[model samples]
Target: MTIRDFESHAPIVDEETFALITELEVRKAVRLQYFVSLLGIEADVEDGQDESEASRTRERLASAIREEIRSCDTIGLVTTEPKLYILLVNANLGNVPLIIERIAQLVSRHRRPGDGLGELTLSMGAACFPSSARDRSDLFAQVGSLITEARRDNAERHRYRLPPAES
Candidate 1:
């Protein structure tokens, strides 16, 4: 099983969208921001207390995130220390902020448990393609770098996400 690097295997899309795709492909990569990585949190639900309750919350939020995501979104799984890797196909640096915000808000509101988790401060970061890096090595580095930048400036303008939330 040869692992394909994201830098090498870009998402195949339309021509007009090609420019946009390439731009995004090399710009947004979900990774650790500052020290807050967006990769894992399912297992960290029990930071202080409520294991069963936390588990329930995780399941609900996970469900919400998965359901809200589109079908084209690519998924990469890594069961290393207990984290899930994800890649929203055709996603880019511009839209990650919206996705992150929607997910965060949904998690916060949908997390029925409300027993522990609050505000749902999920610090996330994304790295795109060629613009962000060159090859696979450079690609990985860019992912981390972008994440760090996002973490530092954690804003609501990451770009290319869902439409404005309904009031």
Candidate 2:
């Protein structure tokens, strides 16, 4: 089955479509002098599950995120990787942490026992237009850097026997 076959309550767009929408939003933000936040989400399911199971986990996580975001927001799935992108129209950097926390809570609530899904981990990074970046490329680059930082932090926590921070 194609990647798009995965079930999601939220509308999931391809990378190209997402990029176009993001560009439009960025332009609007520039003209209106508002804020736009782009969030990059990466979900990791513990190994041992088959491909189908992994895809299901992703779907569930996406649905949970959808519940936390507004109707104006958008979710994009990268078919080549286990990554999801969220476009928060008019949302600024200050609003990112709260959104992330809500998403995390929703995902946790949706988790089921005996599903063999194991522990699902989400690493998120956010960037806001005009504040975190000057243009689309810079915005994406900033998000990528933040994602890398989040992954590093997760790794450090695991290595040091520290509790994982809520995303």
Candidate 3:
């Protein structure tokens, strides 16, 4: 089957988006702000190697993220990384949580126990352009830092997903 047949959501080209962002910056389009989010799926090591499992998890997570995003928005895989980047065109910073929540719901639905998927969960961080970043490079840097912070926060809590509330 073709990619289109399997994946209905057409992801934007990361290179092309980078170029477009450069043009947008040159045009001084400060009024237009895009929400850039970096998302990660971490899995536990089942055996001595978890590379294949991690790869599958990332692909599944990317598909879910692509489906969850708006038509106007774009999702792309970061080069040489397991992370996926989503560009929410003309979206506000406040919308970040809603976006992440959507992704979390999808991830949870897709996750299954002992299917070699491991104890997987999604982690995301978003930054708005012109407000959180001045340019594409700045935006990328900030988003990456934010994801790292999110992971660190999760580590501190000693869990990837939120714990169940006590009755």
lDDT of 1 by residue, 1-167 (tens): 22222332322222234334333543443332211112222234435546456545544454456656664453333333222334555554456667767766675566556445543444444544333435334544444454454445535433111222324
TM-score of 1: 0.48
**Candidate 1: C-alpha lDDT:** 0.42
Top lDDT hit: 2
Q: For candidate 3, write residues 1-167 as lDDT tens digits.
A: 11222345646445456446444642344554334433333333235545665666666666666777776565554444325666666665666667767766776677677656665544555666555666666666666666565576655321232212224
Clashing pairs for model 3 are none
Which should have the higher lDDT, number 1 or number 2? Answer: 2
Residues forming the 10-long window of minimal summed lDDT in candidate 3: 157-166
Where's the lowest-lDDT run of ten residues in candidate 1? 32-41
Query: TM-score per candidate, in order?
Result: 0.48, 0.81, 0.69
lDDT for 86 in candidate 1 is: 42
Candidate 2 on 1-167: residue-level lDDT in tens? Answer: 12243343446677787788889989999999999888887777787878788877776677667767776788886664426888888888878878877877776677689766688787777888887678877777777677776777765321111112337
Where does the lowest 10-residue lDDT sum fall in candidate 2? 156-165
